[model samples]
Target: MKLFRPATLVTLFTLAVSPARAWDYEGHRAVNQLALAALPTNFPAFVKTAEARERIAFLAGEPDRWRNITDDQALPHVNGPDHYLDLEQLEEFGLTPETVPALRYDFVAKLALARAQHPEKFTAIDPAKNKDHTRELVGFAPWAITEYCGKLRSEFSYLKAFQHYGGTADEIANAQQNILYTMGVMGHYVGDGSQPLHATKHHHGWVGENPHGYATNSSFHGWIDGGFFKKIGGVKVDAIVGKIRPAKIVGDPLKPEDLFRQMMAYFGDTEKLVAPLYQLEKEHKLTPENEHADEGKAFLETQLARGGQMLGDLWFSAWEQATEDRYLVTELKKRPAASAETK
Candidate 1:
């Protein structure tokens, strides 16, 4: 329930911005907003809950600051070399649910805690622990989808955990164990699907060191998730506003496997897309702008915006399907009470 303070915002604004962050973040913002739109109707009483309002603000505005995290040295090809165990890193992240083995050095730690596990896995974990709740917000899927989904499954187990445990609205809030955990799960997958790269195999880079040679011109990071929108024209946020679906429409109550199974397609296809996208990544980067950073910025921005839009849709689809063809809340209408009607 700790909302972001201005100081945390300032710090992130000062330090975290980067291309990869930007690409992943727009997705975060889009999905969080979609989640918030659920409140007024799904938990109609939530309208007056300060905690609910806090949740809405936290989720909705959470991603904007991620722009600060992007950096010249971040992993993936765009930021720097695929220096670490990039691909396999995800496979290992998949095992997070197994055990809490190891202390500060285990990958399971990465799966569950992200950065605290990292040594920087979930992007927000480390900062959050450090008391920067602003950056504490999950950047969604900062990694590839396969790795994230594995972790997400563990996180979302709570969607149904309430049934076994004492799942209730109050428990979801201040209750002892895992109140917000499933929501955390949602945060991660929303993040994953949002990243076109996480959803695709091209993942980091194409071929190897030679093709792009780690040059600023052709890094793999932005190439997969971002470069497309750059090549295509920018998306008009205002024009696309009408496309947003309601949260209640986007989500039904909550069931773990059912929700996870629904998004299996995004992850599965992303895995398949990896190899082909990486192979063709050379063609993805828009012309770089040594002379005009704005050109690169514009390209990156448009792509990020598109990514956000896509995240929003996927989020809505999850809820849309969850409704099971019953009345879509957004499509539902209310009638006046008989007395009011007579009046």
Candidate 2:
């Protein structure tokens, strides 16, 4: 696989295992399955079909698969940073949940500005930093999902227009394909955010001044993602998805600034779970047979279910918001002019 930076190669080389992807391929597909099932009643009929679900589940791991591309190796790292955001890293820049910027590039610019001003608090970016930290220092997972949601909305609107304007079979098919790919891509990032490990400084393994003495082993990330599930027969998707609270869209979906508020809210919720994950490791409860593993299992299940619910909600909201606008515009454009006789 292609590495984003030299530092990334070193981190992977040292670890000997821990692939860059979050939640192994199996974990990603499992989450996609749950998200597909939990979609709102108003979701596109096509998405609910068995063929579409199978396609989406298979595509859910595309981001990870892109990392090893042979034809265009650079495409992998271009999106690699969209998987996680370490909220702790934003502190040096004074970017709390309330002040975090709406776009990924803006976030990085702010960090650079902060680094210039507070050289004492933050170290300059160097080749020595691990790839995970390099990405999280200004990760764009939240914004990436919001952007994809907007794209899905546009795709939905066009699909509706095809029906109204007598579009060809090819046009309708193309729109459907776009929608499926966008949803699959968006789901990957959203699912990544659900993993508490993906949001914290202690992503791959515990680091720095640990009084409680958590596991410093490198395999922690891989284990929580797939190993745990493989041993326990996967998460109880139905039970967990049923319990997750209904998704409530709070603001205008078309506006990224407005969407950012809700996005941050969801990210904050996931951020709160980071400590509990480490707590499980500290207590030695991350295995299927361990009596205390139930708590860890419960935490992972909740995160996965929440990811599904949020993705479904975004999909529904985008369709509602965009389709309405598209219909109005198309209707106005097609309306006949008033005759001179009537005037």
Worst 10 residues of 2 by lDDT: 1-10
Models 1 onward score TM values of 0.38, 0.83
* Top candidate (lDDT): 2
lDDT of 1 by residue, 105-176 (tens): 243345456545554443333542333332322122323222333333333343334333434565444322
Candidate 2 residues lying further than 4 Å off, grouped into runs, are: 1-20, 70-73, 128-136, 236-241, 244-250, 254-256, 324-343
lDDT of 1: 0.36
Q: Which model scores highest in TM-score? A: 2
Tell me how many clashing residue pairs each candidate has. Answer: 20, 0
- Candidates' RMSD to native: 13.4, 5.2
